[model samples]
Target: MQSPPLIIGTRGSPLALYQANLVQRLICEVSGRTEQEVIIKVLQTTGDQIKGELKYFGGKGLFTRELELALLDGRIDVAVHSMKDVPTVGHEDLVIRAILPRADVRDAFISVKYDSIDALPEGALIGSASLRRRAQLSVLRPDLTFCLLRGNVGTRLRKLEDGVCDATMLACAGLRRLEQENRITQAVEVDMMLPAPAQGAIGVEVKRDREDLTEILAPLNDRATEWAITAERAFLRALDGNCRTPIAALATLDGDVLTLRGEILAKDGSLRVAQTVSGQVSKTLDAYDLGFKMGEAVRDEVGGRITFDD
Candidate 1:
């Protein structure tokens, strides 16, 4: 009656715009409305404007703080987010209304000179801001050097070709969404480097108690992806994982059994721990416990000196 009174807020980035447009299109279709009937709002977040290593910020919701407040204040009807930046069992006011279908859950190595991470020569410079990527890179190729690099997908790849770095790590899904998949010389397989929890997934956030919005968003939810993240995020939350710490997790579905693989590395990337678990979807919490147990085991393997940068 009031034109659905829907306003979708998202970060102002190429990828964010793309994801928001998608949700906008779907909402328009389902609600029997036109694109003009929906409103799109862009907000700049602390995580988006920051130019240095993300470790400096208190991890989780670094990119969605503004939008979260918007939801709380009813300035916007809903928010779109990349779920990896979200906290599990945390965040007071906003609620994740739906987790859209997941994407390719692997990191892609884009370089004009190299085909894969191992293919790069010794002393090669790898550009990435994620502690998990840095630690794992160090373990696999101790000769490689990691410098703090932050920017949008296009900006990072441009820097790589501009000689700022020999190679850069990015979400494979992001590249593909922008129709630049050919730039991916090699996609880091899950076995080689576990991806972040909720990587390559898009999530819709809305205020709790908004049943009308929830009903509208429920159609986009993917049950398998939802369950997979249930295990992944649970593990991350249990380990107190954050950007300052090097932690990676991934989950896959094989029929009704979900397999979760997780890894944790010390700051220098010297100490590492890895493990895997399989369980039913209904046993999601049990699977999550297995991952946290593995992380705890890793911490024991590394001792308490695993330096998570201050």
Candidate 2:
């Protein structure tokens, strides 16, 4: 009898499929497995079925719960996820086996009439599904009106073309992955709009007891990206971050030094707190500590003013 083909589970979105296929190719090359022996299993997640904003619908887990349940049940060998959509806390029975190399960690401004965010007229309506983006943009342009926009990349683009909103924001990484970079009117700088924690990274999750699968996927992990994501996620975890909270964080590693920048905003974007912390750290735990401390500091600064009440 032959072993079953290695199944890689992922959401059915175009970008998700692209990432899954990329992982499939990399795994095949590294493991010397024939493409026939490896396959992708598309799974529909709760986030996909919802038409409204994600913040109101329980946030990040909606994107990964079904696939995770499949993993726990041994329905799939591994699951690929967009790290940004993953919650800071994870299922105890699973582990992120690998972290793919990072992609562009900046947000892209897309608009048909305006050339850039700055060029938009006052009171320009902006559409975004991310509370962080809406809050950050509100801080920059208080006069702008925001409406909920939710869908896959192509759907969002189509909505933009149909003038569903004057302008919108998307991850530059997704656009580049989908080969739709031309749609980006402006690649907003990180300083202008800090990215969500773990944005632009792909994570592969497997059952904690799957040592063989872990070793097989080990080669795909990038240490630097892992360090950065570790810190950012730790920061988010420390703050108990969720879709309801407009939180943004980015971590960068340079040699032995790691730096983490974080921002938290009021729901209405009326108040904001931002901070940066850096330290000499060579280990993942050290990176995590650095990020967690920063999150705690920021949370303390904000006190009880910010509320998550819907």
Each prediction's whole-model lDDT (CA)? 0.82, 0.93
**lDDT for predicted candidate 1 compared with the true structure:** 0.82
The runs of at least 3 residues in candidate 2 whose Cα sits more than 4 Å from the true structure, single-residue gaps closed, are none
In Å, residue 64's CA in model 2 sits off its true spot by 0.2
Locate the minimum summed-lDDT window of 10 residues in model 1. Answer: 281-290
* TM per candidate: 0.93, 0.98
Query: Per-residue alpha-carbon lDDT of model 1 for 1-310, expressed as tens digits?
Result: 5655589999998999999999998888777767777889999999887877666666666788899888888888989888887777656656777888898988998889988887899899988888888888888888898877788888898888899988989999999988989998999888888898899989899888788887788888887787787778877876778787788888878888888888778877888877777776565456566566666765666577567756
Q: What's the residue-level lDDT of 189 in candidate 2? A: 96
Using lDDT, give the best candidate's number.
2
Q: On a 0 to 1 TM-score scale, where does candidate 1 land against the true structure?
A: 0.93
What is the total number of backbone clashes in candidate 2?
Answer: 0
What are the per-residue Cα lDDT tens digits for candidate 2 across 1-310?
A: 9888999999999999999999999999999898888999999999999998787778899999999999999999999999998888889999998999999999999999999988999999998988899999989888889998889999999999999999999999999999999999999999999999999999999999999897789999999999999999999998899988899999888889998999999877899999999998877889889999999999899899898657
